[model samples]
Target: MLERQSTVGSAPIGSFVALGDSFTEGLGDEAPDGALLGWADRLADLLARRSPVPFRYANLAVRGRLIDEILEEQVPQVAELTPDLVSFCAGGNDILRLGSSVDRIAERFEEAVVELSSHAKTVLVFTGFDPRGTPVLRRLRGKIATYTAHIHAIADRHGCLVVDLWSMKALQHPRAWSDDRLHLSSEGHRQVALRAAGVLGLRPTRSAPATHALQGRVRQPQRLDDLRWAKEHFLPWLGQHLLGRASDEVLEPKRPQLLPL
Candidate 1:
């Protein structure tokens, strides 16, 4: 088991900045207002409520961002913000791609973590979950495992807190995932936010219910369900990769500037 940092519970966070791709961008956790409410946002809300002072937050995560893209584009900006806390979850998009090198990705990922840790009082990193539950993403399970191991090592070396998504049994359920089979569902995001808060030793304003109870009985995907998913999400994603495009190429950051929640 990874040890929690002593500093995690030592102080209240005054500011927070999140960095990463679709998972961090809150894809499946859509708000009633049509905004994405990923785990990072939820965590920020929790921190805001617990904080004795005003809390400022910014989320620079854009979907489909690669590790290098986050390092080059978001890291400098995040460092400038100099927030008290930073949550970074990237490189899953790179590992899911064909012919990607886990070692090379890890090197870049570690570099970014080191840089971010230097700027922020606390840096949070996440391990990629096992994709074996998703039909299409199942093939990348081995790669995801390898990448997740690297993440653990990197986070340890930098003294950063790690949220081990790989071992979250509740996330293995199909219902915890979105129709895309890549991102987490709204409930999944909520559970993650709760887990993150626990790591940081912060009590949320509202209680988070058990993830397994919310999911109920696990149902296997039918043939029609798989076909529908492939037609609706997988094929378009494949075409985008083939053409060297990304879903977030034209999308903007949900919260570009830091503001009080």
Candidate 2:
């Protein structure tokens, strides 16, 4: 169980900008209007409550974005928004591809970090969550671990805070992820928000929820679920790559501008 039992304290964040791909965009954590309200938004709400001045936020995350793309497209926006805080969680999509090099990805990631550190007062980065408990993603756990180590080293070198998702125990549970086993769920997003707030030295206004929940054994056949996931989620994603079409190519960022909450 996690514990966060304090109102928005004296943490001095005023504006924040989030950059990366689906996770930062809140893909699995859908809102009522069919929009995703992922962790960055949750953390922004917390910051808004804690800060003495008006807090503004922008999320430039688009689904299926690569780290290089973020560096090329998103990082430049930091100079304009000039938010006091910036969160960078990328390279997962890059890692998922075949022939992807962890070292190369981390190098590009660090480049963005260097640029971000110069622009924002507080630069925040997230390590990839542990995937050992996941069947499909576990094979890439080694790569994830390697990248995470680089993330920590980069954070240390650049004087940035980290939201070490690799160590979050609660995310191991099924509920923390969506059906695809890639993105985090709503509760997972909440957990991430709580962790990010802690990293920024902010206090939550409420208690933290238990990391694990009791999800009774499923009666449905496992093979059926796997087939469905492959058909509904995996195939289309793979098809996009085969056709050289990026999912977010036509879509604009969910929150393009930094605005008051």
Highest-lDDT candidate: 1
Poorly placed runs, candidate 1 (over 4 Å):
1-7, 203-207, 214-217, 246-249
lDDT tens per residue, model 2, 1-261? 223422223446778899989899998999988978999999888777656777789999988788888998999999988888899999998887888999999999989998998888888899998988665667889999999999999999998889999988777777778887668889889889988888877654565755445233323327777678778877787668534665655867989999998
lDDT of 1: 0.83
Candidate 1 at residue 28, lDDT?
A: 96
TM-score of each: 0.91, 0.88
Cα error, candidate 1, residue 228 (Å): 2.1
- RMSD (Cα, Å) for all candidates, in order, is 3.6, 3.4
TM-score of 1: 0.91
Q: Each model's C-alpha lDDT?
A: 0.83, 0.82
Model 2 gets an lDDT of 0.82
Candidate No. with top TM-score: 1
